[model samples]
Target: MNLTRTHAHAFDAFDHLATMVAVLRRDGRCVYVNAAFESVLGLPRRALQRGRVFDWFVDPATLKVTFDAVVANEFATARLEALLRRPPGAASTEPLPVHAIVTQIDHGEQVLLELVEIEQQTRQDRETRTLDQARITKELIRNLAHEIKNPLGGIRGAAQLLEMDLESKALREYTQVIIHEADRLQALVDRLLAPHRRPHMVSDVNIHEVLERVRALILAEFPKGLVVQRDYDTSLPEFRGDGEQLIQAVLNIVHNAAQALATRRQDDGDARIVLRTRAARQVTIERQRYRLALELHIEDNGPGVPPEIRDRIFFPLVSGRDGGSGLGLTLAQDFIQQHHGLIECESEPGCTLFKIQIPLP
Candidate 1:
C-alpha cells in the first residue's frame, strides 16, 4: 500500500469515528490528530499536528512509558491506563482517567494512538473505601445491636412492670413510645447488617436477568402511567457473580427511580424509567482496564436528582427523598464494587441516568 494513500484512508477513518485518535512518528512527534482529539483535549488541530505527543502529557514519567512502548515495538498495540493531569497554568489540573492505546504502524516507523476518558475510576475508589467502611459499620451495628437489644428487652420488661403499678395514662404512653422507638432502632440496625450476613451464592448469571427482574418489580408497583423500558444487548456473556447481590443492587436503583416518579404520577406526568445494557470495550474500573465490560444503565425521567445531594448520593445517609433511609444507594454501590464494577449518576432537571459497568468473568 502507498504510504500517502494509506495515511489518507487512515485519517479519513479516524476522522469519522467518535473517539479521540492521533498518529505520531516513531520519534514521538505528532503527525495526525483527529477532530475528536482536539475537541476532547481542548487543543487546536494545528497546534497538535506537528508538536510532540510528550508536550500534551502533563507528567513526564507517563510519556516515557508510552513513547518507549512505541519505539521498542514490544507489542503491536500497547495500552497505558494513566491519570492525565491538566497542563500547568490551566484553570484546574484535575486528574482524568485516560485509556491510551499505542499501535505501531508503517512497519514500526509510526505510532497510532487512541484515548478515551474513563470517568468511573475515582468513583470506584470512593466506593471501595465506602465498602471497607461499611464492613466496619456492620461490625459496629452487630455489637451495638447485641448490646442494646438485650438491654432494651430488659428495659421494656421493667417499663411494663412500672406501667402495671402506675395509674397515670401519660406515663404509660411515654413507656410505649420508648419501646416503639427502641424496636425501630433495632430494625434499622438489622438492615445495616443484612448485606454482610447474607450468604454468598456465586453462579454464572446473565446481567439482563437481574435487570429484567428489577424492571418487573418496579413496573408492578407503578403500573398506571410509569413506563419501564429496556434496551438490552442480548449477546453479552454470563459472568460469575452473586446473583442475589446483583439483583438487590439493581433493584435498589430501580426502586429509587420508581419512588422518584411518585410526584409525576400524581400530576399525570410522563414517568419513564429506562434499563439499558451494552458491551463496553476497553473499560477501566478500579484502576484496571479490561478488554470488555458489561454496561448497565438505569435512567429515569423524573425531577432528577437534586443538585445539592448529587455528589454525595452514594454516601450512606445522604438522600434527596423525604423519609428515605438513604442507605439504599450506598448498599447498591457496595455490592456492585464487590463484583469489580462501579455505578455513576448524571442528573439534570428532566433526566437522571445511573450507569453501572461490571467486568465479564
Candidate 2:
C-alpha cells in the first residue's frame, strides 16, 4: 500500500483508539490496520495487509455484502455484528463478537471499519448501572442507620433499667433477650455504616502485599483443605491507597471464596483459589479513561455464585448463605470505589471469578 504524507498522517491517528480499526478499498483489500486491530488479531500489520478484511470475519459473506452496499452509495454507514477469530490458545477459545461499523471515507473508494467489542460495551453499561445503584444504596444505608441508631440506644437502655427492677426470674430472662438482640442489631447497624464513616487512610500500597495478607488469613482460618495460589505481576507499580482498607477489601473476597468451597473441604477435594494480578493498559473506569490500570482476579474452583442473588451480591443485606451478614462484598465494593476502581464478577456452576480494576499512577 502507498499513501501521501497527508493521508498517512491522518490514518496514524486511528492508532490511539481502543477500538479495532481498519482501512480497506472497495474491493475489500486491507489498506491499513490500527494498533488495536493488530493486537486483537494477534497478527502483525504487514501480515494483516496481505489479506482482505472480508476474510478476517467468520461471516465473510455478510461483511462483503455490507461493503458492496456502502460503496454503492446505498448508505454511507452501516453497523453489524460479526465474530472475529482469535489466535489459538487464547484464554477463551470462543470467537470474539464485535459490533462492526463501516463508513465510506469521503468520495474515495476507501472505507474505514471500526470494531467495538460487544462484551466490553455490556460490561461498561453494567458497571455504570452498578455504580449508580451503589451510590444510592450508600446514602440510604447511612441515613437509615442513623435513624435506627438513636432508637436502638434508647431501647437497650430502657431494657437494662427494666431488668434491674424485675424481681421475677422469668421477667429478667425476657429483658436479657431484649438486651442481647438489641446489641446484635446494633452491631449490624455499625457494620452497615462502617465504610461511610471510616476515614480513608492513604499511602503507598503494594497489591501483592495486600493479597499476601489476605492469603495468610484465609490459610490460617481454613488450615486444612483450601489452597490459596498467588499469581502476581511483580512489576506492577504501587499506587496511593489505604493499605489496611485494601487488605480488608481483598480479605473479604478471599474469605468468601474459601467459605464457598465448604463442600470441597468436607470431601477433602482439591479446593483452590487463585489470586491473579496484571497490568491493564488503555482502560476506562467510571467513565474516566486511564493509560494503565491494575487488574486483580480472585477466582475460585467452587460452585459459582447463586444465580438468584448474583446480580445483587454487592448490595447490602443480600447473601446466598443463610445467617450471613451479607456486608462483606458491600464493604469491599465501597473500598475499591474510593480508589476510583471497579469490581466485576462472573460465575458458572463450577467456577467463579471476581475481577477488580484500579487505575495505576
Candidate 3:
C-alpha cells in the first residue's frame, strides 16, 4: 500500500462521522478510510486501505460498473444498493446490506464512497413502534387506573359502613370480604400508576453498580442453584439518571430470569444468568444519535420466554408465568423510558436475552 501520510490528516474529519467513507483512486486504489468503515468491515485501517473498495462488496461486478460510470464523468455520482462482505470471524455469515453512494471529489482525482447500513432503518422502525406503544399504554393505564380507583374507594367505604351496622357475626364476615377485595384492587391500581406518580431522582449512575445490585438480589433469592456471571467493560463512564429506577429496572429483568430458571433448578440443570456490559459507540436511541452509550445484556440459560407473551412482555398485566402479575417488565420499561433508554428482549428455546441500552454523556 503506497499511501501518503498527508491523506490520514486530511481524512481525520471523516473519522468523526458515523457514516462509512472511503476515498479511492478511479481504478480502485484506496487513499483513505474512516473509523466507521474500519469498524463495519472489522479490519484495521492499513489492511482496508491496501484492498480495493470493490473487493469489500459481495458482488464486485455491480460496484465496478457504478465506480466506472462515476469516475468517467458519465454521472457525477451514483448510488447502488449492495451487499457488503463481512470479516471471516464476524458473527453473521450473511453479507451486510448497504446503500453505497459514490461521488466525484471536487478538483481531485479521488472518488468518495459512503456506505450506510440498510438494516439500520429496520431497527429504527422497531424502536419507533415500541416508543409509540409505550406512550399509548401509559395514557390508557392512567385513565383506566383512575376510573377504577374512584369506584374502589366508594365501595370500600360502603363496605366498612355496612360492617359496623351488621349485628350478626356471619353477616359482618360477608361485608369483610368486600372490604378486603376492594383494598386489594386499590393496591393494584396504585402499583399501576406508581411510575407516573413517583418523582425521577437524577444523579450520576454507574451501570455496573446497578447490575451488581441486581446480581446480589437475584443471588440472594436463589443462592444455591443460580450463578450470576459478569462480563463488564470498565471503560463505561457514569451518566445522569435515576439510580433507584435503574436498579429496579435491572432487578425486574434479572428476577424474571431467575424465576424462569426454576424448572432447570428442579432438574439439576445449571441455572445461569450472564450480566454483560460494554460501551457502545455511535448508537441511536429514540431517534437521537449518541457518540457513546451503555449496552447491558442480561442473558439466562433456562426455558425461554413463552412465545405467546414474548411480544407483549412489556405490556401491563401480561405475564409469561402462572400467577405472575406481569407488571414487573411493564414497570421496568416505563422506568427505563423515563431515562431516555430502551429495553429489548430476544428469546428462544434455551436462551433468553434482555438488552438495556442507555445513552451516556
> In order, what lDDT does every prediction score?
0.79, 0.90, 0.89
Give the CA lDDT, 0 to 100, for residue 85 in model 3.
Answer: 93
lDDT string for model 1 (101-174, tens) is 88888899888888777754455566566556655664665687578767767777787788789888989898
Worst 10-residue lDDT window, candidate 3: 1-10
Q: What order do you get sorting by lDDT, best first?
A: 2, 3, 1
Q: Which candidate is the best by lDDT?
A: 2
* Candidate 2 structure lDDT: 0.90
Quote model 1's TM-score: 0.66
Q: Give the local distance difference test score of model 3.
A: 0.89
Candidate achieving higher TM-score, 2 or 3: 2
Compose the digit string of candidate 2's lDDT tens values, residues 194-281: 8878898999999999998889889889988788888999999999999998999999998899999999877966899999999987
Report clash pairs, candidate 3.
Answer: none
For model 2 the TM-score comes to: 0.91
Candidate 2, residue 165: CA error in Å? 2.7
C-alpha TM-score for every candidate: 0.66, 0.91, 0.89
Total backbone clashes of candidate 1, pairs 3 or more residues apart or in separate chains: 0
